[model samples]
Target: MNGHADVGPLTSLDLRLQWRAAATADLADWAALIARTAAVERPVWFERRADLEQILASKKNPAAANTILGFDPEGVARACGRITRNPEGEKAIGFGCVDPGWQGSGIGTGLLGWMEARTRQRFAADADAGADGGSGAAPRLRLHMEQQHTHQAALFGDAGNRIVRYFNEMHRPLQDGFPEAVLDGGLELVTFGPRLHEPVQLAHNEAFRDHWGSEPRNEEGWGFVVNDPLARPDLSAVVVERASGRVADYQLASHDAGSAESRGYAEGYTDLLGVQREFRGRGVAQALLADAMRRFAAAGMDKASLDVDSETPTGALALYAKMGYVAVSTSMVWDKDL
Candidate 1:
């Protein structure tokens, strides 16, 4: 796979802009460019430079190499995008943001095409290396857009991508006192700790196996999430089945001050919440969520936020609603078979 074309001039753009693969040195500018995109749409959440670093941590493709940036003559970033092909790659996920000024000038379309090609390139590299071609299903390139931004959805539609799924960003005010985690049967709730790291990762893979676009987390990728600087083990909890000492369910939570900057109150987030198939209807999730919410309140957070698949058969949306979480925003997942 030729990686050279990954970065260069953007002659396709209607405006004068240069496209180049990002480097560690460009993270600050890369993040600033995305913030500008969000600022134009809704300044509700912001990602700190560190967050981008954590997201782009990879052995196969370093943060700098896996990301691309579009800059104007002044050396200012006007667009940014990243590509991630998970180990169990049924899908290659593409994330992008364009400067509001450059939105209508073909930057979005150009960036999407670049990522799609990069996805193909990555998969070809894997096949060349004799890696298992992942489920032997047709490869797909996926992109997500906030539902409020119909224009972004239209962009994907114009690119031949189809709506594959929907997701909701839900928030819960830390009012109404937090509830103590209570599990029936032989289940016990405990704070996530060092010893449980790999176990939790393994459990997460099983727990989410049936969910849409879910991919098994390879050790390196799992480490990125488990060891994130913003991760709060104190706020995360796992439900264990005492008899077999198996992880019945888990809630992985984090606090990102940068994300809550626009809000009047501090926010803690449930980054991942999963329940083993056997434990789904037995209250494992409820207990973990309650435990996380309690910890968040104790940590002085004024609200809790989580993103959930709208079409999950696990009834997560209803449960979250039952627990007082309400949809604040929505995002749509679109995919184009590669």
Candidate 2:
């Protein structure tokens, strides 16, 4: 995407604003800014631009704008946020970040204001054209931030939004090894190979649709995932009916050996765990979690961690609790009306 456009002639903080859609060309600088901020603020893992590009590729195109990069009166890109239409056509905005030097200077507030106006205008125009189908647009917006990020919480709250959910970052020490549990008769747990990738991805996409603020993962998402070199297909576990060749439930685990963020030691992570709706309450989640923990332990990793939306309709908190995963940290969601 192009860099922030010039803010010609205006010098006031509010009047000096200019923004432009982020393009692939800006990925290097954008990723660098994000990486630097992440290192100082969270320092959990390595943030590679390539991985982000892959993830972004899996998503659907935005209705109007994909991302907004903000600039000062001097024409410098310093802040950014993303806006996209969810599966239900609800416009969601998230991943807002401002440079540390520019914090508290009203830049973030300006960006939010711009987003609000843009959101309402787009919704109104769509509504007028009968494109809204008379659904009476709600103009939804969502954001996720670390729990301790009080400044961001204040920013969104001041903008007239409330915390809808608090997601917990859970971790278990993997270097200590995972306990193997014997399954009762007729309840066999199996780890499937690449052959089960599509079915498992579909099951997860369906299960996550009911999740809070989640958009359905399209076929392109599965295609990107199947071709991803980072994904360990053999390390994934899929719950089986034993007699039938059907996948009742599944969970995916990934490892970044060199990055401390992936392993929970200021690096490394084991993320992406989901269970099919039909397979809930049958110990499928636990089985898959345990299997992932085992794989992480075998890899000689120090820790395994993942984030879960505590307000999830699936009672995930209780499930994770039962599996011995505890909260290491938390994040809050911020939102506002245009």
Candidate 3:
């Protein structure tokens, strides 16, 4: 029997809600559903099975089950949701999507409600286990949606979620060429290598600590980055502090060949860019971006893309703008106390 067999039916449709924990076999179906939904909800975005696999493998809190699928009586995956708790269990990140055909039929809302309840239950268990014993407030629940999905945003709003953050999906045309990267006196640039993965991961966590909704990555999460088949280590760069010989900043890049082909242009993606707090103002970020652009150009890519918070403390959006990146799309983060 399906896990959600006992759940009530969706009011607007004849579909009975059936729940199940996602397994390795579900990757293809999940990717297919995401693609089908994105074709209408977010045409510019691409979802891949590898990415889904990585997400499933990188569950931060193993004891807190998060992946839940809502299926129809016919065993079709009509909706899915996942909630990932941070290490401290003080915050949980939630995301879900409904099959476009069933979107307005209330599957999305039902999935979200189920995810919220599951998250709360997990948080309560964590609290009882002394994981979040000291904090008096309930864990924060957050979800992200593309800004263009106004209807979905309205639904989330009606469900008591408020906008908390906005992110710009920025793109730069590499065919136009790029400026020379200037490194400060105390910093040295090095190509990404297997040896630098651990240090880079540590520096990334440190750098992103102050960012809103940021969470430190564990080994599994870090592995998802380094082990990804699309990662172009040769095109990526890391800046090391000459004095301390520590990773001060880094850029991890990837080449999405399918996406590039779909768009009729070769493109490189800047998957992650982070600079240590103490090294922020020393031109580290600009240098890293320039290096990535240069590499993309050399690789015959027509464009490079990355996403940044609009309200980033590091002025990342402005910096990307200065580097000739333009906003192609925007996504919003919705949050509520759970």
Candidate 4:
């Protein structure tokens, strides 16, 4: 019943399902719908029900206003869509999936139109209120989908959205020993601590400031990362400049039991990795990744994984390759000018 197996034009609208803004009460239904899609396209990446609950609670994507769900007569969610509002950013990012049984029914197309309109409205409201300094740039709608979802390519194409960038999911086995990485003479390595959360966030913003599509995360957006219920501080690593005690690089790691069980292998993930602009060329990233792999191995994980922009300006893809990671899957960004 996965709609992803076949894709069609958005001409037919399935009006049997009732559409409404998401609510906390719909968490179970929405998560089930998400799981169905993940199984068909991205089995290694599934969101646990609790994770969906936490997402519903996020201010930037609150269930009450920013998210929508389509429910059938039996009250089962059949389609879902939402936009992540980064007020300071020039793009509105969307995340959604249609129910497996309803892929070619035009529900996804209808959901996409709603999302595009919703994004335009948000931009207009912000411009009128002079929010985020009103940078005067034309707003864009961006969405991410795995390359394996050929049906999505058709749907997005029909909607006038085109591929913008490619990303790779790289993974290295922990069953084998990790490479030895030494910190630079002026830098020291340390585990992530609660006291360093905000510092790490600041360093992250400064590090990825120039990376494509990376916008500075305000307090709430940053909160979504540091406050993750399964964040592994012991597995996370930070690099500090010895002389000034400045955070030069950081790698945040976490693992979920549900995801591991679904994939049939345990993995420790580098959710975020960043190097301060001043320290990019000092092998800081290599050292941090090596350090992360060792931690994952020690923590009994079977592998270590992270995603990278294929055309990243920093040559991160080569570095990760040198570190023994191999690209296992690809996800792409699609953009439509509004």
Which candidate number would show the highest TM-score if scored against the true structure?
4
lDDT by residue (12-124, candidate 2, tens digit) is: 12444455666676677667667656655664444467665764564454412556666667666577665544334566565567777778889777666656655665566
* Residue-by-residue lDDT tens digits, candidate 4, 36-122: 878777655766677777787887555655677777888788888877767767888887888888889888888888678777767
lDDT of each: 0.79, 0.64, 0.79, 0.82
Worst 10 residues of 4 by lDDT: 1-10
If scored against the real structure, what TM-score would every candidate get?
Answer: 0.90, 0.79, 0.89, 0.92
- Model 4 — TM-score against the truth? 0.92
- The best candidate in terms of lDDT: 4
Over 4 Å off in model 1, which ranges? 1-15, 43-46, 63-65, 134-136, 179-181
- Candidate 2 regions with alpha-carbon error over 4 angstroms: 1-18, 43-47, 55-59, 62-64, 71-76, 87-91, 121-136, 182-194, 221-230, 256-270, 312-315
State each model's C-alpha RMSD to the native. 2.8, 4.4, 3.0, 4.7
Error at 142, model 1, angstroms: 0.5
- lDDT of model 2 at position 161: 78
Query: How many clashes show up in model 4?
Result: 5
- Scored by lDDT, model 3 comes in at 0.79
- Per-residue lDDT of model 3, residues 1-338, tens digit only: 35533222223222466667677888888788788787677555555788777776764544126677666777777777777775464578887788888877766777767767876766776778776655644867888888778888888998899998888888899878796769989899999999998999999999998887677777877887898868899989999989989999999999978766557888789989998988888898999999999899999899989989898887888889999999989998888887
Better of 1 and 2 by TM-score: 1
